[model samples]
Target: MDKEITIYDIAKGVGFSPTTVSRALNDHPAVNKKTKQRIYDIAAQMGYRSNLFASNLRRQHTNTIGVIVPILNSNFQSSVMAGMEKVANEAGYNLIISQSLGTMEKEIANAKTMYNSRVDGLLVSLSHDSESIEHFEPFFKKGIPVIFYDRVAEHKQSTSIVIDNVQAAYKATTHLIEQGCRNIVHITGNLKINVYTDRLKGFKYALVDNDLPYKKASVIATDLTEEAGIKAAEQILKMDPRPDGIFVANDFCAVNCMKALKQAGIAIPDDIAVVGFNNDPITRVVEPNLTTIDYPGYEMGEVAARNLTNYLDALSDVNITNTVTLRSDLIVRESSLKKKLKK
Candidate 1:
């Protein structure tokens, strides 16, 4: 294996001391501009790579942020990560991302890895069935800043950036009710998550406001996966009087459910209307384009990352732990358009 080149190698070749080479590499103003350029040119010629670990040890700041998410394939989470990466990169910081695969054990392990890696901060979206956030206690104890986005947990020191799921869900359900859908069914993920639980509350509240009966069977809680959509369809189809409308927690599940319903010879909008959340790209691509909520996921990520960066840069001391609710809106489409079309 080829040996890694160091500053000393560059220093020897450039006729400068290691200290001068090191300072030049770090862009210290003490080194003359021409001398610094000479050292940099020689370092590049010698294939020198900066050691972030040693640099972090010297500055007591890792220049690395750790991010833990349930899964990496989801469109929403990927957009969030993209936004985070853009902000972190602009700030001269690196991001170390890991997936929990929606398992608490994996999440715990990831947390420990981040801590051991000496990350300056952490950003987490908790896993399903993660009852407690005990894994993050080490970060809290070590004075590391932890920020939560999307799937957040209740923690005093950490901050959360999310939309008002209750309000968004309420708007979606109410829109369906306005379109004359009384027997509305809500398909969602585990109610253990604040997002799902809040959406459930919103669904009920919308029903109550419209004088519609709120039935436990009306709210079907699942993992909100593609298979879960088919299962939800089966459950709804089994009901004596099938639901006239459905409000799904996410666009992917909603689109899949629509496919299942279509396969069952159900006419969308004419027979049953549907509304989905997140406004994912697939929503628009699918036939009878899904009506959804325009969730600002990337914006949420940018705001969360920027908030932490500001705090780290000594630019601000604003409290971020308090709920930071971003704007979300109902996007009406063919799936939920029930009004008579004027020809």
Candidate 2:
């Protein structure tokens, strides 16, 4: 293997002191622009890479933010991550991302790893089963800022970024009601998570507002997977009086459920209407299009990242801002539009 180039080698080759070379490499204000450019040129030519480990030791900051998310395969999560990366990179900070795979144990392990890595800040979207935020006590003790987004928790000292899940869900359910769906079923993920629970609340509230009976049997709790959606459709088919509407907590699951219902000879928006959360691309591609809530994952990610970096740069205080709720709205489509639109 070739020898790794060092700042010392760049200093020797450029005829500058190691201190001067180091300052120039770091873009220290004391170093003139010409000196910095010359040092950069020599370092690039010599294949010299700045040692982040050593630099972090000197500065007592990793300049890296750790992000823990539930899953990575979904479009919503991918968009969020993209937004986070753009802001973090522009702010001269790197991101260390990990997935919990929707388990508390994995989430705890990821939190421990982030703590040990000494990340300057942390951004987390809690797992489906994370019962407590005790794992983050180390970061709290060290005064390292932690911001939670999406599936967030209640931490008096930390900030949470979320959408009004209850309100979004209310709008979806109310739209179904307006379309003449009285027997509505809500397919949701585990109610243990705030997102699912809040959505459930909205579903019930909409039922009450419409003077419809809220049936506990109508609320089906699943893992919100495609397979679960199929199973939910099967269950819906077997109901004594078939549900006229379904409000799924996720787009992927809702699309699968729609497919399942179609295969079972059920007509969408005619026999049973469907609505989903997260305006994923699949919603548009699906047959008859899907009615969904536009959960702004990308904007949420940008806001979360900006909030963390602002605190790190001493431009804002997390304590002053408890929760940042982003805007969300309903996008009505063929799947939920049973009533004729008046021209």
Candidate 3:
């Protein structure tokens, strides 16, 4: 086994005190830039790594932020995390990320782990079944900021950054109607969270605006996964009068449904036009490019992390506001354009 290097080894090699090496490695502003550079160079030459836990304990700060998401493999969530890491890294903060697997049990366990790890702050997009947020009480008691993004929860004082899901869904539905789809089906996620519930409301409002009757059967609430998409497609196919249009909550799911519908011999844009959300890369890759709502996952993450950092540094306040809504755009494509022209 190779021998591990320490601050002592760097100090000995550079002829500087271990205290100076430690302070320099920590980027203490009091340490002159020249001294800090020399210490860093020596440390690199000696292959020395600072003991992060020991340093954090001494400084009374972990310099680490915890992030919990439903899944890490998701394109949307990954983009959000990428944005968060970029901002947090630039601010000299480390990110400790975990997945909830879309379950409340896993989310609770992750919250506990983050709490026990002594994370300086937390950012969470709640799980599909996360009804109660009691697990986050410890962070609140400790004055550690907890911000929610995307799949958010309603807290009296905590900050949440998200786009207006209701309006986005309304736009998607209204677009379908404009393209000549009256009997539209709305496929969405579990309505326990605000994102899905608000979108459902928007879908209803769009129908009501055009004087189309809002029927309970028109709304198909599910987990919004690929499997759920297949199931929705199956259900739509079996309907007495098949839906003229479909508005899905996620692009991935929408793409999956498109595949399933095609397998069932249903022609997309001709038989049933579709619109999806999140504007994921798959939307463009799918045949007959999908119309979607551009949910700025990366931007949301950057803004959330920056705001939390500002609050932690006492440079900004979040208590005065409860929610910060970002802008979302509707991107039209062949998938939702139902008008047929003479060829």
Candidate 4:
């Protein structure tokens, strides 16, 4: 194995002292532009990569933000990560990203790792089973900025950036009602999550507002995976009075559920209309494009990162009790349009 290149190598190669080499590498104002460029060119030629961990220890700033997401494999999360990387890169900060696989235990372990790494700030979207902000208490005690987005909790010391889940779900449910759907099924994930709970509230509220009976049995809480979607569809088929509409928590499950229903001799819209959340790309690829909530996942990520970085830079103050709610609206598509589109 080749020896790891260090500043000493660049310093010797460029005939400069270690102090001068360090200042130039760090872009210190004391270093002349010409000298700095020369050092940079020499450093590149010598294959020297600065020890960021040691540098961070001296400055007490990592210039790195830590991000903990529930899962990395979803279209929504992918878009969110893109937005975060864009803003973080533009701000001269790097991100250390980790995933929790939707489990609270893994999320707790991830939190511990981030804390030990001393990330300048943290952005987290809680796991499905995460009941409280206890795991993030260390960050709070240290006065480190922590921002939650998408699936968030009500912590007195952290801000949450999210779309109004209740309103978005209500809109989706109302659209189904307008489509003449009286009996509807609500498919969702763990209700322990704020997003799912709020959506459940909206679903119940919409039913009651429309003078429709809200039955607890109508709500199916599952993992919201493709397989779970199929199982939910099979369960729906066994119901005493078949539901005319379904408002699933996410597009992945909704699309799969729609497919299962269609296979079971159910005609979408003509029989059971369906609506989903996150307006994922698969929603469009489905035979009848899925009607869903257009969640601004990328924008949510951008806002979360910008807010955290601003706080870290002392350019803005975050109100822990405050929430940055982005715009989210229902996108009507063929799958949920039981009524004829008026010309």
TM-score, one value per model: 0.82, 0.82, 0.81, 0.82
lDDT of 2 by residue, 37-154 (tens): 9998888788775642233453378899999999998899999999999999999999999999999988887887676667999999999889999999978877788999999998
Q: Candidate 3 lDDT, tens digit per residue, 1-343?
A: 8887887888889888888877777655557999989887777667664543233353367889999999999899999999999999988889999999999988887887676667888999999889899989977876788999998887765789999999999999999999889799999888888898999999999999999999999888888888999999999999878899999998989999999999999988988999999999999999889999999999999998998887777778546247889999999998988785212
**RMSD for each of the candidates:** 10.6, 10.6, 10.5, 10.3
Model 1 CA RMSD to the hidden true structure, in angstroms: 10.6
Give lDDT per model, in order: 0.87, 0.90, 0.87, 0.89
38-81: candidate 4 lDDT, tens digit per residue:
99888877766553333344337889899999999889998999
Which ranges of candidate 3 are over 4 A from the true structure?
1-59, 318-321, 340-343
- Residue 171 of model 3 has an lDDT of 99
Candidate 2 TM-score to native: 0.82
Q: Estimate, for each residue in 1-343, the C-alpha lDDT of model 1 and write its tens digit.
A: 8998887888889999999987777655578999988887777777776642233453378789899999999999999999998898898789999999999988887887677667888889999979999989978886788999898887888888889999999999999999889899999999899899999999999999999999998988888999999989888888879889999999999999999999998889877899999999999999899999999878977887887788777777776567788999999999987764211
Cα miss at 24, model 3 (Å)? 35
Q: Which residue pairs in candidate 1 have backbone atoms (N, alpha carbon, C) closer than 3 angstroms, thus clashing?
A: none
Q: What TM-score would you give candidate 1 relative to the actual structure? A: 0.82
Residue 207 lDDT in candidate 4: 91
Give the clash total for candidate 1: 0
The residue ranges of model 1 lying beyond 4 angstroms of the native Cα positions read 1-59, 341-343
Which candidate tops lDDT? 2
